[model samples]
Target: MVEFAICLPFVITVTMAGAELANYTTTKMRISQLALLVADNASRIGSGSMNAKTISETQINDLLTGAGLQSGRLNLFQNGRVILASLQPSATENKFVVKWQRCRGMQQVTSSYYTATNTTNLNLPVTGDIDGITVKNHLVTPPSKGAVMFVEISYTYQPLVSLQFLPSINQTINDSAALTVRDNRDYTGGTSGIYNAENATRSLCAQYTAT
Candidate 1:
């Protein structure tokens, strides 16, 4: 009976450590996948048209809402942040700019890359190189006259079981993904017509909300 009592604490600690490790790995993967999903979907937005496609505020809201729903039990919007940006090159093609950007989530964070309508150039190379894997490297080179849909996701890890005896393992998770526009998009007006609708809510980066 004494041996059993002594061994119980150790066994419990081991089990908790194992579970925490698993949860951490899964959260990392989910954040990565979420980045990819949002970037891909952003590139595919707007109605299919041979000439060019335009996105509205309503569509952007829907995209963000979809991300929140897909987060499932993670409660992503409530605890994390999502920033979406449309990266386009300058008329000279020598510099890249953030033509437009949108954000959602209650987390108090902003994009590390660029801000909306910023004339600042991106650090990426102007030459075309899309074979890179990491988020920063993926867009090492830019496409001519085309834009890239970039997404950044930041999530705070929530441990399933707190182990007072063990060292704290909490961490802030981050992942990013980018995809070139799949079709021609209309960027002439920037975000001028996005909120043309009477009831569309703009997901401004300055504000944070789960909704």
Candidate 2:
């Protein structure tokens, strides 16, 4: 029938759109999971080791490496990025500051959704405690003094099915996760006086390798 032929194109377009939407949704969830896993691993850097009281630059690198391993299926290193930030209570009460940061993967990733508190934005208030935050895995506690692993992951998504008829959707996907350090971590870089790791044995930073 003539009408059947006309309707076929619309039907095919709708099916393709649905499939693409599903794939995008799954990709977004994977990104969120990757962020949480990296943050959790970073927060638990010294866990299960009796002598390891403080986190080291090597541990930071290892955490990022673990992130890459977890995202093997996602092909994150080639197409995405992960940023790991250490947040701690500033000298001033009721405030938190990003003590140090490291990143990995090809695509440079920073917390673009929200800027990290730099010198000018040092007065960022500390919200509620770790119990308020929830994810699939139960979170660990922070240092008694207070420290957090803030993670952000960004990935450029390639569509499974391209729809020329539909309005173009931005393929960039991002997610953030925060976890409190369960162990007493050295806020200072031991001898460095700042958060910059004195012994950066490996490079985890993508472009900004300062921390």
Candidate 3:
């Protein structure tokens, strides 16, 4: 009986640890799927004209809302730098860059009013806290006479759970994705202009949002 008692705690601990690890793993996979879904949807919206004076936040919101995600949960980042919370754009030429930010909510919770429950909402405390995530897109703008337009997408992923347990759990997580873009048409001559535009966009949109 003493031997059984000694081993029982160990067994329970190991089982609970495994359960935690599994839950974390499932969350990681769901995040990946979310990233891919957002990126794919954003790319479909295409790049609106940089010179066009009237850009609609409603349209952008509609895009996200249509995808069945809350508009409050989506953030638009341009280049690698600018956080275009609304899809309003300033005049530019040749390249359009953007990323999406999302946050993971609490998986389980305990509160003073109630005990821990599985039916609790799994949304983060803050809405737009995409501290770590992947955002990717490809944009094809109207082919200019001598230059082509391109779209760039980037992502930064921070684990919702602590990094200390990631390796032991066999999960690989990152806080960010390298900036990447795809252009449908090739350009020459005024290529420098396009490159300069892209650089500016990237510089403005490259920070992570924890909230």
- State which candidate has the highest lDDT: 1
Against the correct fold, how does model 2 do in TM-score? 0.72
CA lDDT, every model vs. true structure:
0.73, 0.64, 0.30
lDDT of 2 by residue, 1-211 (tens): 9999999999988998888888888889889998989888887776333433566667777777777777766778778878776666555555445555667767766555335434222123323222322334544233547677888788888678673533477688878898887666555445321232465654434263322
All candidates in order of TM-score, best leading: 1, 2, 3
Query: What TM-score fits each model?
Result: 0.83, 0.72, 0.36
Tens-digit lDDT track for model 3 on 163-183? 454455444332221222222
Residue 109 error, candidate 3, Å: 23
RMSD of model 3 against the true structure: 15.5
Task: Give me the displacement of residue 72 in model 3, in angstroms.
Answer: 14
User: What's the CA error at residue 194 for candidate 3, in Å?
Assistant: 19
**Tens digit of lDDT per residue, candidate 1, span 103-185?**
89999997765533332332323223223223554443347667888889999877778644336654788988888988877
Q: How close to the true structure is residue 102 of candidate 2, measured as C-alpha lDDT?
A: 65
Q: Tell me the deviation in Å of residue 22 in model 1.
A: 0.7
Per-residue lDDT, model 3, residue 87, is: 15
Clashes of 2: 0
- 198: Cα error in model 3, Å: 28
lDDT score for residue 64 of model 2: 79
Candidate 2, pairs of clashing residues: none
